[model samples]
Every structure is written in C-alpha cells, then in structure tokens.
Target: MRWGTFTSSNSVLLLIDHQVGTMKLIQNIPFETAKRNTLALTKAAKILGMPIILTTGTENGFQGPLLPEFKELVPEAYDARIARSGVVNTWEDPEFRAAVEKTQRSHLIMAGVTTDVCLYSPALSAVEDGYPVQAVLDASGSPTELSEQLARQRMERGGVTLTATNTLIAELARDWSRPEGSELLKLMVDDVLPPVF
Candidate 1:
C-alpha cells in the first residue's frame, strides 16, 4: 500500500458500529480508552472539516445505537442506524455505500467496534472496490486480543492501512503552518494522546 497524507477533500472518516452493547464486548483495550480515542478522532476530523459517516448496525436488536457520546460529537454527519434487519458489514448496506459514493473521496479513515467484523470486513471491501482504507487501530476493539491481532493481519494483507488516531491527525495536519495544526497539537495532548510535559 502506498502511503499518503490525508487532505480534507480527498478523504472521509467512517465511525462504524460504535453501539453500546458492542462497546462493552471489547477486551483487548480499555473500553473507555477506545471510546476516548474514537471521540478524539471524530473531533479532529470535524475540526479539519473532513467528510464523515457515522453508522450503527442492528441497533434495534442487541447491538443498540451508536454511543450517545459519539453521536453528540458528530451530530451533523450522515447517521445510518440499521434497523432490526441489517448486514454485519456496513459496506454491504446500500445506505452506507451510497453515502460513501456521495462523498467522492478516495481515501477512507475508519474506526469501529469489533475490529474483526465491523472494522475489517468493509475495509477489505472498500479496498477491493478501489478505495484506500485506513483503520485506526486504537480506536477499534474486539472481544479478545487474538481476535484483534488476526483482524489486523487480515486487513493488512487485504491492503488496508492499519494505523492510529495520532497518525491520522498528523497526516491531516501535514504542515505546522496550517492554522489547524495548532488545534491538532492541542487535540493530541489534551484528548487523543497522553500529555507530554
């Protein structure tokens, strides 16, 4: 996979299946940390004006809706909450595909609950469909460490760029001179990452 920076116009952020029940199943990382990183990523994307897609899967069933905290952060982005009948892969959902197609962006920055399912499946599909997909590792979680590790390997093999929230923030900033650069720095220290000094 060729590495490149993210420009607001060329990239879109996807927050998928971040439902309450799903969030409770993550065992590889602290649930609170994953939620925090996910929120930070969303806030950074919002500040940089990146096109975003917020989605939930089987919300009317056991998974529940997108986390209220996340919804509160990106209230303006297109929200796709799948009803009782829904596909596990959001990419398989017509509404999701339509929203992605409508964005016209070639690069996708994605993070979600259940790294093995919600994060990996669509990432592979998007790559197959010709979109460069980047998965924010720390922002996604799974039921077990082994599950998350295997999912990461599969995604990497399938041409998805496995990354972290900080990397995405830096890629979007690219230059310290840009006004958002400072905001990015503040986000890094204050929210997305641990403070240094």
Candidate 2:
C-alpha cells in the first residue's frame, strides 16, 4: 500500500471479534500482548479520529463484550458493533457492510481475534470486492506463531496490505510538524514506540 497516500483519504479501521472469549484462544501473541496491542491500535484510531468499526460474534453466550480499554477509548464505537449468528467472514454480515458504508471510505484497516478465521476472511472478500485493504497484523493473532505467519502469507498473496500499528500511526502523522504531533508522540511513547526504544 502507498502508506500515506492511500491511508490519508479513504481509510477506515475495522476491529473484528476482539472480545474476551475469542482472545483467550490466541496463542501467537499471548492473551496479554493481544489485549495490549489491540488497545494500542484502538487508542491510535481514536486519537487519529479515523473511522473505526468494531464487531462481535455471539457475544451473549459468554464471548463477552469487547475489551474494557477499547470500550473506554471509543465508546462511540458501540453503534458499530456488528452482532452476527455465524458469519465467519465478517464482511459477509450485513451489519458489517452497513458500518463500513457509514465510514464513507473505501480503504480498510482490519484486525480480528483469530488470525486465520476472523482476520483472513474479510480481507480476502474485501480485496475481491476491489477495495484496498490493510490488515493490521500485530493486532490479530492465532493459536500458534506458525499459523499466524501462514495466515499473514495468505492475506499477503490475496493483495491485502499487512502492517503494524506503529506504521499506521506514523503514516497517519504524515509529518511530525502537523497538529497531531503531541498526540502522536504520546501514542508512540505510551503505546507504539516504547517497546522498540
């Protein structure tokens, strides 16, 4: 993806099934890291004011609601919760479609609980539909690192833009001199940049 060029205009973030239950099964990145990284992305999305949409599958049966941090970061996101029966592919759900439509943007930044199941399906479908898609890799995970890597390869082959949250943050920042400077720096140090430092 052309990073700054495309992301600057028609990009929306889609967080799929990042709920309590689904995250517990993710082993590639421990549940804790998954939780932290997901929240990091959420924080960046909110700070950047990007169009972010969230989804949950069968939450009433104990999947639980989205993580508390995410809830607090983007409370307005409640209206975007896509509840589905068994549409493994989030893109297949009508509610998901409506949420995406509401963004009024075509480029999509997507992440989900399970690397292969939750993340892959929509990415492939979205690409097939001719929409530019960015898969936020660190924010998505599976039971094993190998599986996660393979799923990433699969998404890559399908023409999805796979990237990290830090990359997205920097891309959105465009130039540090912009008005989002302090906010971006806060996100970088508090969430995106610190680990590497």
TM-score per model over all chains: 0.93, 0.91
Which parts of model 2 are misplaced by more than 4 Å? 1-4, 195-197
Candidate 1 wrongly placed segments (more than 4 Å):
78-84
Which candidate tops TM-score? 1
Model 2, 87-110: lDDT tens digits are: 899999988898898779878888
lDDT of 1 by residue, 1-197 (tens): 67476677799998888888899989999998898899888888888888878888777777887788755777666344333256888888887888888888889999988998889999999999888899998999999999999999999999998889888888888876778988888888889877567
Every model: Cα RMSD to truth: 1.7, 2.0
Please report the TM-score between candidate 1 and the true structure.
Answer: 0.93
Candidates' lDDT values, in order?
A: 0.84, 0.80
**In candidate 2, where is summed lDDT lowest over 10 consecutive residues?**
1-10
